[model samples]
Target: MKIGLVCPYSLGTPGGVQNHVRDLAEALLARGHQVSVLAPVDDNEAPPYVVSAGHAVGVPYNGSVARVTFGPRTAARVRSWLADGAFDVVHVHEPMTPSASIIALWAGDGPFVATFHTWQVRSRAMSAAAGLLRPALEKLDARIAVSENARSMMVQHIGGEAVVIPNGLYTKRFAGRIRPDWQGSDGTISFLGRMDEPRKGLGVLLSAVPRLVAERPGLKVLVAGTGQADDVRRSLPSSCRDNVLFLGEIDDAARADMLTGSDVYVAPHLGGESFGIVLLEAMAAGAPVLASDLAAFRQVLDGGRLGELFEPGNATALADQALRLLGSIDERDKLRATGLSAVLRYDWDALIDEILAVYDLVAR
Candidate 1:
């Protein structure tokens, strides 16, 4: 079977949707199914079937960018790709985006599926556009969401329930590809995601770092991912500033190094995460994680038994958890072991089989 993936984000974005597509594409290829990606090209050398989706434009509702629409040009390319029967199913990732969704809506006659990946948090105005796009989503042979929370939100707004197809991780993709600049040492707490705004709890991580460092003095924090990294870098207090290393937007390899080297992965995320794909990635890399106790995060963290859970946006609790992990070796190992084992529940093979089952059900 040949599969076509249409994602609004690029390969280099390092977000859940893009990473999901990357893993799913390769997983499909490994199964002898031809997979193609339609997205922005960040790196010149990409998977064989990828077509450039142009640079992204920032969406008003979400911090992330939606791919630029080339009007009929994009439509033509999409139609040509779909019309060729080169794909048995067209899997559209993040179908609400204006540009990418339009391309998917206008594409071809094959069985098409849309995976909704966002909360649509920007504003009320974007709903008009979202409303305009509902038919296309309705037209999908099947629809999916990364988490139950995501599926509920999509149903409430779009008037339909999409099957919950959790994202999968390609655990060994970064084997032996540690970052050159990464120097793994004792007592390092890591934050790996977009470093913008207070929502992601970068501020909480920054606030917690100083308190943790003051207690242990050996505690260092590694902040990974790209957006607004400068804000995080600048806001770091003088004492703990040097101790906090900023790894601005990394590839799979760098994320692997950070996860493998760090004592604990911290994501105090307050909003916009449905499944928290990064949490699973960290777990797969054998890093103990400290995350918010949101329902979606709980699903990813295995109901908090697999890792430390704290209130979202709480700096003090976050600090306490960080300090605890920094000092303990046995608990850290336990969290790591538990996390890796838990991720086996969401492996690509199992996930794809479930997804295919949905396709069969929906397409019928």
Candidate 2:
């Protein structure tokens, strides 16, 4: 079957939806289905079977910057791409968002499947505009949500029933990757995500550094991903400064290595997380996880059975939990083992069948 996976976000940037689309395309191709990814491309090269509609510009949305193309030219280009692509099924991620996905859904022939990936506390005027948006949304023959949280948001605001299909993982890449050089003795605690993003709670994580190092002088904090280092440093107290190392924007290999080497992986996101993809990545990487008590994190951690949880935005709680988990090697190892076993259910090879079934059902 020929499948066209449409991602509304910029393919050039690193984002959860963009990454999921790319990985899903590859998995579909490996399963012998012809797949093409359609999205706005910037500096990043278009991988095999990827079709770029145009470039994208970042616009603030849902407490984050969304790189999406939403203009007459983009719409025209997307319509042309859809007309020529001749795909049997078009699986669009975030179809309601203003981008190629919306344009394609409006212009392209049906058997359309839309996947919802976000949920926030506030509705952002979308609920009020539902009457105007209903026609466009009705084009979707099937709808999917990455988690129960995402499905609930769609039902409350947009009035739709969507099947929940959690994000898939490149399990072998994280599980079997070699540990990076940074993963040596003295113990490493790692955090991955944009430091300047308040929702990620990097500031809260940094606030715990002083207490963490005071408990274990040899422990090191590895802060990965991109953001303003100065802003992060200002959040850290003077005493904990020396122990924190900023690793700006690491590739997949480095991330896998860091997670494998780290004594603990911290996800301190405050809210608006529909699914815990990074937590699954850490689990797949064999890292003992420590996460905030968000509903999304709890769902991914199996109600705190797979890993430890701290109070959201509470630095003291984070430090205390980290110290307790770090002090016991046996406990960490047990958690890691449990995580590795549990994450297998999310492997792409297993999850793809469910997604393919969605496509087949929609097509029928």
Best of the candidates, TM-score: 2
| Candidate 2: residue pairs that collide | none
Q: Tell me the whole-model lDDT of each prediction, alpha carbons only.
A: 0.74, 0.87
The residue-by-residue lDDT of candidate 1 on 1-364, one tens digit each, is: 6677887776655567777888888777887777778886666777777787665555544654443454666677677666664677788877766666557765556578888877644456656766877766667888888888888777767776677888887666523334435543447678876666456778777777777878877566788776766666777777877788887877667778788877788988887677888788788888888998878888877788888899988899988877787788999999988988888888886787887776566442
- Predicted structure 2, TM vs. truth: 0.96
- Residue 33's lDDT within candidate 2 is 89
The most accurate candidate by lDDT is 2
Model 1 score (lDDT)? 0.74
**Superposed Cα deviation of residue 28, candidate 1 (Å):** 0.9
